[model samples]
Target chain A: MDFFHVLVVLLESTIRVSVPLVFAALAGLFTERAGVFDIGLEGKMLGAAFAAGAAAAVTQSVWIGLIAAILISVALSLVHGYASITQRGNQIVSGVAINFIVAGSTVILGEAWFRQGGRTPALAEGARFQTISFPDADMIREVPLLGPIYADLLSGHFLLTYLAFAMVPISWWILYRTRFGLRLRAVGENPGAVDTAGISVIWLRYRAVICCGILCGFAGAYLSLAMTAGFVKGMTAGKGYIALAALIFAKWRPKNVMFACLLFGFLDALAIRLQGTPLPLIGQVPVQFMQALPYILTVILLAGFIGKAIPPKAGGVPYVKER
Target chain B: MSTPYAKLPGWVEYGLIPLINLAVAFLVAGLVVLLVGENPLEAAYHLINGAFGRGEYIGFTLYYATTFIFTGLAVAVAFHAGLFNIGGEGQAYVGGIGVALACLWLDQTMPWYVVFPLAILGSVFFGALWAFLPGWLQAKRGSHIVITTIMFNFIASSLMVYLLTRVLKPLGSMAPQTRTFAEGGQLPKLDWLLSIFGLDVGTAPFNISFLLALVAAFGVWALIWRTRLGYEMRTMGHSPSAARYAGIRESRITVITMMISGGLAGMMALNPIMGEQFRMQLDFVQGAGFVGIAVALMGRSHPGGIIPAAILFGVLYQGGAEIAFEMPSISRDMIVIIQGLVILFAGALENMFRPAIARAFAMRGQRAAAVVQTRGA
Candidate 1:
C-alpha cells in the first residue's frame, strides 16, 4: 500500500479509538476545572457503559440507551460529588469505592437479569450504532494525500465519533468564551474569588459536573453501542483513566486534550496492528509493550518532562467559605 | 462540654475515628441488606457469627485473613506516606505468580523451610518490582499514584491472564494453573501445637502465617513511628516541603515506601502458598488487594487497626459465599453489594456526621464553628 493509503488506515483507526477517550477527557476536564477530584471517571464510564449496552439491548434503540446511560452515570457522579464536594470526603477513596461498586454491582446485576453471569445480553442490529460513509467517497479519495487519509479514516465512523471531535471546539468554547467557563475556571483556580464575585460556586460546579456526565455518557455509548455493540464485564477497561491522563496532558484545555487523545489513540492503533505480527529479529511483539505505552506516556507528560503541564492549582481541593 | 472530647490524645483521636468509621460502615451495610430485602440486623448477625462462628468457619477465615492482613497493611503503609496505592491487586497477583513459579520450578528440591521462605521472598521481589514502576512514575515522572497504579492493575490482570493461559499452563493438563507445589516446597502443619491447645482445630487450615501477619503489623507500626525512615514518611505525608527542608529525600522515600508497601502486599500471596492449599490458582489472591483498600481505609491507615477491619471483611466474605447455596439464583455476588457500600460509607466522613453536617449546611455555614476537619487523603 502507498504511504497515503497506510496513513488512511491509521487515521481511521485513530479516530475510532480516540472518541471514547475524548469524551472521557472532556468529562474529566469539566470536573477538574470545577475543583472536584474525579478519579471516579473510570467508574462513571463503566456504569454508563453497562447501562447503555443493557438499555440498548433491551429497547433495541441506541438513542434511548444513550440517554439512559447519561442519566445513570450522572447518578454515580452525584454520589462522587456529594462525597468529595459536599462532605469533603477523601476523593481517592470515594473514587475507588465507586469503581468497585460499579464493577461488582454490574456483574451481580447482569447475573440476576440475564443469567450470563458477567455480561449483558448482546444487542441486535437496531440497537447498535451504524458506521457512516461519505456520499462522494470516490471523489474525496482522489483529492490529495490528506484527502485519501480523510476518505478512509474520517469516513465510515459512528456519528458520535464526529461529535467527539466536535466536542474539542465545543468544550473550548464553553470553557473559555462563556459565563459558565469563567466561573468554572475561577472555581478551580480560585474558588474564593468566584465566591466573592457573587456567583454560587457550588451551583456553578454542579452544572460543570453535569455536563461532564453527559459527555461521558457518549463515551460509554461509543464503547458498547459503537465499539463492540455489547457490554462485557469490566469492558470500559482503563480507558477512563487514560482519558484522565489526557486531560492532565492537555493542561485541562479542550483543544490540547484532543491532541493527547489522538496520541494515545495512535498508540492504541499501533498496538492493535502489531498484535500477532512477528518482528524481523525481535520475534513476536510482546503485548505488554503496547499495553504499557499509554501509561508510559502519561507518566512522562505528568512529570512535566514534556514541557510544563500544570494542573489547576485547586483542582482536587474542596473550597469552603473563608473569612 | 467539659468532657474528654474537648481534648483527646492524638493516637486515640485518630484511632477512634476508624472505629466510628466501622460503625458507620455497619449501619450502611445494614441499609444495603435492607435494599436486598433481607433483615439488616439478622444479616449483620450472620455476618459476624459466620466469620467467627463455627470452628470450620474460623478455619476458613484464618486461612483467608492473612492475605487481607498483608494487603490491608500494604495499602495502609502507602496511605501513611500519603500515596493512594491501588496497585495492591496487581502487586499481590504478580507476587502470587512469582511464588508459584519459584515452588513449581526452582525450589522444588529445597527443604520445606528454605523453599517456603524462598517462595515468599520471590513474591516480595516481583511485587516490589511491579510497584516500583508506578512508584518511579509518581516520584520522578510526577504521575498521580492513583492513575498510574490503576493502569498497572489492568496491565497486570491482562498479562497474568495471557501468561497463565499461554506461557505457564501446566504441562499434562490444559488447565491455566500451575501444578501443585512439590512435597518439600509445602509448609508443614503445626498439628502438634493445635492439639496441645485442645482447641479442636480441624486439619489445621490455620497456619503460622497469622502470627507472621501480626508481627508484620507491629513491625510496620514500629517502622512508621519509631524509625528514621518512618519519621521521614510521616513528615512527608504531612508536608512534603517541610520533609524536604528537614533533609529527607522526598523522591527516594516515595520509591522506598512503595517498595515496602508492595512487599507487604506480596505477603498476601504467601498466604495461599504457605497455607494448607500450598499453591495459588489464578487470582488466588483474588480481589483481596482491592478489598484491602477498604480495610486500609476503615482501619484508618493504621497497622493494628487493619486487623479487626480485615476480620470483619473475612467474615462477610465467608458468609456471603454461603448465601449462594440457599438462594441459588441470588448467588455469591450479593456480598459485593455489601462490601462496596461498606467501603463507601466507611470512607465517607459526611455519612458519619450526616445529620449534623446537613443541619449545619442548611443554615448556610451558620453552624459551621471553625470547620477544620479536612478529610484524610
Candidate 2:
C-alpha cells in the first residue's frame, strides 16, 4: 500500500474506534454538567449492548435492537436519577452500585436467555448496521490525493459514526444556547441559586441524566451492531472509564470531548497497528503501555500537571432543600 | 429528610436499620432470581447449604472471607479520614509484587516464618507506595481521590501485565505468571484449627492467613478507636474545618490515612498469594478490592461490623459458585448483583428507611410522656 493508502486506513480506523467513546463522553458531559457524578455510564452502556444484541439476534431488526438499547439504558438512567436526585443519596455510591448491578445482570441475563455463555448470537446482515457509501465514490477513487481521503477516510462509515460527530455541534448548541442548558449548568454549579430562581433542581437533573442515557444507548448500539458482529462478554473493556477520563481531560466541554475521544481512539488504532513492530531507539513498544496511555494521561491531567480540571462546583454532593 | 427528632437507641441505629437494608437488598436479589425463571427460595437454600454444608465448604467460605476482611478494613480506614480510596484493587495488585519479590529472593534460603514477616513488610511498603501517589495528589495537587485512584487501577493492571509477561515469566513457561514458590514461601494450612471442631479441612486453602486477618482487624479497631492519630482521622472525616481549627495537619493526616488503608489492602495479598496460589499471577486481585467497598458499606465502617459483613459476602461468593454449578442458568454473577444491591441500600440509600424509623420513635416517646402525665394527674 502507498503512504496515502496507509494514512487513509489509519484515519478510518481512528474514526471507527472513537465513535463509542464520543457517544459515552457526551453522555457523561450531560450528567456531570448537571452536577451528577455518573460512574454508572459503563453499566448503562454494557446493559444496553446486551439488550441490543439480544433483541437484534432474536428479532432480526436493527431498528428494534436500537430501540431496546434505548429503553434499557433509559431505565437504568432513571434508577440513577431516582437514587441521586429524588432520594438525595450519595451519588458516587449510587453510580458504583448501578455499574456493578448492570455488569453482573447483563451476563446473568445473557446466559439465561441465549445459553451462549454470556454472549448474544452473531448478528445477521439484516440485524447489523452496515456502512453507508457516499455518492460517486467509485468514480472519484482514481483521483489522486483527495480521492482516497474522500472515499476511504470519510465516505464509507456506519451511520452512527456520522451521528456521533454530528452530536458535537448539537450538544454544544444545546448546552450553551438553549434555556434548559442554562438551568442545567446553573443547577450543577449552584442548585440553591437555581432553586431560588423558582426552578426544580431535581427535575432538571433528571432530564440531563435521561439525555445522558439516550447518548449512552446509541453508543452501546454502535458497539454491538456496527463495530462488532455481536455482543461479547465484557466487550466494553473499560471504554466507559476511558470516556470518563476523556470528559475530565476535556474539562467537560462538548467540543473538547470530541477531540479527546478522537485522540484516545487514535492512540488505540496506532497501538493495534504498532504491535510487534520494531521501532528506532524504542525497539518495540509494549501494547500494555499503549493501552494504558489514555488513563495515565488522564491522571496527569487530573493532577493539574497539564491543566487544571475544575469539575462543576456541586459535583458528587446531594442537593438538599432547606426548609 | 433531615428532621431533628428524638435520638435513636444503639440497637435501632446500628442494628435494626442495617438489617432492614440488608433484607431489602436480598429481597431485590430474590426478585432477580425469579426473573431468571429460577425459584429464589430454592436458590437461597442451595446457596446457604453450599456455603455451610460440608466442612470443606466452611473452610472455603472462611478463606474467601479472609481476603474480604483485609480489603474491607483497608476501605474503612480511609473512609474514617473522609477519603474514598478506590485504589484498593491497584494497591493489592502491587502488594502481590511485594510478596512475590520476597518469596523469589529468599524462598530457597530463608524459612517460611522469616519470609512471612519480610513478605508482610514488602507488601505493605509497595501497596502503600502505590496508594501514596493518589493520596499525595489529592492532598498536594487538589485532585479527586476517586478519579485518580481509578486511573491508578488501570495503570496498575497495565504495569502488572507488562511485568508478568515480559519480565517475570520463567524462561520456558508461556503463561504470564511467576513460577511456584519454594517451601519457605508457602503458608501452612490450619488443619488443626478445624480438627478441633471435628471437621476435616479437606482440600480447602484455609491457612494461617485467617489468623493474620483476624489480628489485623483487631489492630484496626484499636487504631481507629484508641490512638491519637485515630482521633485526628475521625475529626478530619467529620469536619475538615474543625480539624484545621484544632491544629490538625490535614495534608499529613490525609496522606497517612491513605497509606494505612493501602497497607491494609496490600495485606490482602497474603491470603491469595502466600496461603493459596503460592505465587503471583496476573489479575489475582480479581475484583476483591471492589468487594471491599460493599463490605465496608454493609459493616458500617466499623471493624466490628466489617467482620460479619465480610463473612456474609464470603457466603454469597461460595454459595453463588455452588449455584452456578447446580443451575447453569444462574451464573456466579448473581453474587455481584447482590453485592451491588448491598452497596446501594446500605451505603447510598442508607437513609431510605431512617426518616420513617425516626418518626415512629418520636411518636412513641411522646405517647409515653403523655401516659406519665396522665398517671401523675
Candidate 3:
C-alpha cells in the first residue's frame, strides 16, 4: 500500500482502538467531577461486558444485550454510591471491593452458565454489532483523497464509535452550560456550600454516578458486542485504570479527557503496528516497552513534570452535614 | 473514618466484630453456593478438612500464610503512615531479580548462611529502590500515592516480563525462568523441623521463610510501636499540618515509611523463590499482594491482627483449591468471590453493623441506670 493508504489505515485503527477508552474515560469524568473516586470502573465495565455478551448470545439481539449491560453496570454503580455516599465509607476501599466482587462473580457465573472456561460463546452475526457504511460510498471510490478518507477513515465503523466521539462535545456542553452540571461540580468541590443552597448533595452525587454507569455500560457493550464477538475473563484488561490515568492527565475536564484517551489509544495502536518492525537506530522497539509507555507517562505526568493534576477538592472524602 | 467501635470493649472491638463480619460474609457466600445446587454446610466441611485435616495440608496452608504475612505487613506499615502502597506485587517481582542476582553470583563461592543473608539484603534493597521513586513523588511533588503506586505495578510487570524472557532465561530453555539456584542458596524444608516433634508430616513446601515472617512481624511491631520514627509517621498520618507544626518533616517520613513498606513486601519473594521454587519465575507473587490489602484491613493494621488474618486467607486459598478439586460444579473462582465478600464486609462496610451493636450497649447501660435511680429514690 502507498503512504497515504497506510496513514488512512493507521487513523482508522486509532479511532477503533480509542472508542472504548473514550467511553470509559468519559465515564470516569462524570463521577470524579462529582467527587467520587471510581477505581471500580474496570469492574463495572467487565460485568457489563459479560452480561452483554451472554445476553446477546442467548437472545440474538445486540440491542437487548446493550440494555442488559446497562442494567448490570447501573446496579454496580448504585452499590458504589450506597457504600461511599450514603454509608460514608472509605471510597477507595469500596471501589476496590466492587472490582474484586465483579472480577470473581463474572468468572464464576460465566463458567457455571456456559461451561466455556469463563467465556461466552462466539456471537452470531445477528447478535453482534455491524459496521455502519456511509451512504453511496462506492459511487465515489474513484475520487482522489476525499473518497478514501470517507470510505476508509470515517465510514464503516461500529455505531458505538460514532456515539463515543459525539458524546465528547455533548459531555463538554453538559459539564459547562447546564445547571445540573454546575451543581454537580460545586458538590464535588464543596458539598457544604451546595447543601446550604438547599440542593441535596446525596441525590446530585447519585445522578453523576448513574451517568458514569451508563457510559461504562456503553464501553463494555462495545467491547463485547462490537469490538470482539465474545466475552473473555478480564477483557477490560486494565483499560479502566488507563482511563483513570487519562482522567488525571486531563485534569478531570471533559474535552481533555477525550484528547487524553485518543492519545493513549493512538499509542496503543502504534504499539501493535510496530511489533517486529525494525527501526533505524533502535533496531526494534520491544513490545513490553510499548505496552508500558502509557503507565510510565502517567507516572511522569502525575509527578508534575507536565503540570499539576489537582483532583476535585473534596474527592475521596465522604461528606457529612453538621459535622 | 474513626472506628465506631472505639467505645466497645477490647474483645468486642478486636475479636467479636471481625468474627461477626466474617460470619456474615461466609453466610452470603454459602447462599451463593446454595444457588449453584450444592450443600453449603457440606462445602464448609470440605473446606475445613482440606485446610487442616492432615499434617501435609496444614503445612501447605502455613506455607501460603508466610507469604501473606510479608505482604500484609508491607501494606500495614504503609497504611500506618497514611500511604496506601498497593505496589507490593511489583516490589515482590523486582525483589525476585535481587534474589536471582545474589544467588547467581555468590551461591558458588559463599556458604549457605552467608548467601542467605546477602540474598535477603539484595531483595530488600531492590524492593525499597523500586518504591523510592513513587514515595519521593508523593512526598516532594504532591502526587497521589495510590495512582502512582498502581502505575508502578504495571510498569514492574512489563519490566519483569522483558527481563525474564529476554535477559534471564538461559540458552535453549523454552520456559521464561532463570536457571536453578545453587544448592547452597536453597532454604531447608520444615519437614525435618516437624519430624523432631516425633510426628511425620508429608513433604510439603513449608520452609524457613515462615520463621523469617515471624521475625519480620516482631520487627514491624517494634518499629511502629517503640521507635520515634514510627510515632512521627503515625502523627503525620493523623494530620499532616499538625505533624509539620510539631517539627516532623512529612516528606522525610513519607519516603521512609514507603521504603520500609517496600522492604517488607520485598521479603515475600523469599518463600517462593528461596524456599520452594528454587529459581526465579514469572508471577510467583501471584495475587497475594492484593490479598494483603484485605488482610491489613481485617487485621486493623496491627501485626498481631495481621498474622491471624493472613492465616485465615491462607486457609481459604488452600481449602478453595480442595473444594474445586472435589466438586466439579464449584470452580476455583468461588474462592475469589469469598475473598471479595470478606474484603467488602471487613474493609468498606466495616461499620455497617457497628451502630446497631453500639446502640444495644447504650440501651443496656440506660436500663441499669434507671434501675439504680429507682432504688435510690
Q: Among these predicted structures, which one has the highest lDDT?
A: 2
Report the lDDT tens digits of candidate 3 across residue range B137-208. 999999999899889999999999999999999999989999988887788778876677654557668888
- TM-score for predicted model 2 compared with the true structure: 0.98
Candidate 2 RMSD computed on C-alpha atoms after optimal superposition onto the true structure: 1.3
Ranking by DockQ: 2, 3, 1
- Shift in Å, residue B197, candidate 1: 7.3
Tell me the tens digit of each residue's lDDT in model 2 across B125-152: 9999999999999999999999999999
* Overall lDDT per candidate, in order of appearance: 0.78, 0.93, 0.89
Error of 2 at B339 (Å): 1.0
lDDT comparison, 1 vs 3, better candidate: 3
Model 2: per-residue Cα lDDT at residue B147: 90
Give DockQ for candidates 1 onward, in order.
0.36, 0.79, 0.72
- Note the residue pairs that clash in candidate 2: none
The i-RMS of every model, in angstroms, reads 3.6, 1.2, 1.3
Best model number under DockQ: 2
| Per-prediction CA RMSD (Å) | 6.0, 1.3, 1.6
Pitting candidate 2 against candidate 3, the one with the higher lDDT is 2
